[model samples]
Target: MPLAALVLLLLTGTLVPINRKFRETPGGIPVFVASNGLHTDVVVPTQDARTGLDWRPLLTASGQPARPAAYPFVAFGWGNAGFYRSSRGGHTPGVGTTLRAALPSPTLLHVSWCAGPPQPGTRVAALRISAAQYEALAATIRASFQADSVGRFVPAVMLGYTAQDHFFEARGRYHVLRTCNDWTNRILRRAGLRAALKAPLAGSVLYQVQHVPKTRNH
Candidate 1:
């Protein structure tokens, strides 16, 4: 049955990762995976130490209440465009909007700034990866952005949930299979980090990080 197949897939996805040997290199770039109970985001610095990929140029901070660029950490999240833009956690989205997200739909990149690292708890986990790995991860995030004619990430018209954060057009489909957590896991895999093979849920990815090779050097 379809329900049985989906259950099996979720079980396999939760239990399996692309690489069991993925190790968190000693003295690697520090990053954190932040989850808001249901959704996940990859948190990095304004400028990566290895690649020097500055997001200051692309993100909007003009006429804002806070200076996002000055923040110590930046978090990147991807999800359904309409859901993300209109969502304030104030109320659940309408039936139509929720149904649309169940299908292949437009996605948006949610870029938010954090003053400090996410506390290592159930909702937040930290990882240390090599410079090469960090750069690769950053590259993947960059590629996820929907580029313009000149290959630039345009800021979405909708105002951000916070003064320091803003939304931008992103390339991907937000559906049952390709959820926000799945995108985060894919980025980790591309960067050679410990990531679930199919992480459609935030808990799936968070649980796998606990099994990654840890180093005291971090």
Candidate 2:
């Protein structure tokens, strides 16, 4: 395979959701269009039915549509980097300055992904959880774990196995975890959110350890 094609496949394949068909933006970037193919999957539309939270129709500063609905959590993993790259870089031309720049002023909550080591050149996928949904998810994590430490559970929840052949080929777990960390840190800084929210941050290293691959005991 050609080097550029190999790189593109690695970046997109690992990042794009596989259980559904994708629709590309005018910029030529592919997006997780809908939740299909996975027979028993849950489809949490970008527009929450009950609350009418339509994150799907969010528009960039330049008036370009930011298609958050294209990718659902059950299929596309929840890491911030993809969105950061897509919004900040010129990937979707005239989209916005960055995810932060495009957000409504006085932004209550924000998500971002930081470029790291390999840099991956440009980010490929992205999504945003509504304030209500973010709160609900945070509450669930707190209730289940008895702490509001979101950073801790991020890796295990977002990163996992995927059937792709590229940089993400056999690299889903670590890649996801790494992307999650990059995102968590960036958002915390951008929103001026404390490392520990509502409770003293605890068990951080243990949280990072979630990336360790498991093995059968001898």
Candidate 3:
């Protein structure tokens, strides 16, 4: 081969990847985003009245029949289980980053975005706790929020997953104010906890509000 041709061939081989990413729909979840050689899928567990275990097509907040959030968690689930990601075919995006329990009895799992870019003064924060620990955390949150009725629920637990990495960190680090809005936020603000962090975090925010009944029925 000519010298120039030989050099070009070597450069091409080095630049191109050996394998390309394909979409993966493990567990029957649908894929949402596909980019930079990555596949992501989000599944919200649902059950059919007759079938026992069936998947209801996921929908967006607007109720306009939209796909799940793409890439890094487009939205946060109320509890601690669901999130969205991009998809293409069968290959999923790499294990972006994840925060999970220490095994044997994992409680919570936090999937993460790439970590190199470094947010100004933040790092990914994931948490996992045992049943006891979760209960304890819930109680602490109720106390912190000064929830009207602590006994109404075993600490109305909710997970705040954010598409923006900063929001995720803030949710992990700040007080109830950072994690909640409206009445919940009002309760936290009145409790004297600031929203933005001034010092380091002592624990995660536990935001709870009384589920008062109005004239309308459930």
Candidate 4:
């Protein structure tokens, strides 16, 4: 029965949308969804004051000093910590770790400081959503971070990293049925954007975002 359910999920997860409504935002806030072939990340402008996210603590918690100009945007990605951390530093995790991550396991939030927006033809989708939509997306991202009693982001020290990015403890568990792309899709949906209902692959999310009309009148 479990195998049958898993097959059903994988089959239904790839179903394409039909007659999906694509709305336009009047001078909406620009955001980007990027994919590195395997995983996806949502990038938002750091200078957006309305987000109410203090970069100081995030930067300090990252344990990597960064300049404002050097990182105009912050990219957030969520996934299983075991697979995510092992994939870092050109190290591949063992099959046991991968299997555990593919099942139910602890998750982590990966943050990367970006200099500019995602490049063209690089599996990146850009969207201009309303301020309300952006606010919802930002709130969803912020809520993913696990905070201490004082409300500071709690860093996950089990992972080793050499890049400007950092990882923090995140809410929920990661599994094959509910992967990082699903989290990204959920966030986009929260912002009133069209996305796959259950996208476990990065390509699935990008495919749905590509269907949006480039230009639409209010």
**Model 4 C-alpha lDDT versus the unseen true structure:** 0.78
lDDT of 2 at 130: 38
The stretch of ten residues in a row with the least summed lDDT in candidate 1 is 60-69
How high is the CA lDDT of each candidate model?
Answer: 0.82, 0.25, 0.23, 0.78
lDDT for each residue of candidate 2 in 105-218, tens digit (9 for 90 to 100): 211112111111111111211223334433443333222211123322121222212221001111122132233333232232232222211111112211221222322230
**Two-way TM-score contest, 1 vs 4, winner:** 1
TM-scores of all models?
A: 0.91, 0.21, 0.18, 0.87
**What CA root-mean-square deviation does each model show from the true structure?**
2.4, 19.1, 22.6, 2.7
Q: Which candidate ranks first by lDDT, i.e. highest?
A: 1
Better of 1 and 2 by lDDT: 1
| Count of residue pairs whose backbone atoms collide, per candidate | 0, 1, 11, 0
Ten contiguous residues minimizing lDDT sum, candidate 3: 204-213
Angstrom error of the Cα, residue 142, model 3: value is: 0.8
lDDT of 1 at 95: 85
Among the numbered candidates, top TM-score falls to: 1
Q: What is the lDDT of residue 32 in candidate 3?
A: 18
* lDDT per residue (tens digit) for residues 12-73 in model 3: 43233211221121232211111111111111223223223222122122122333323322
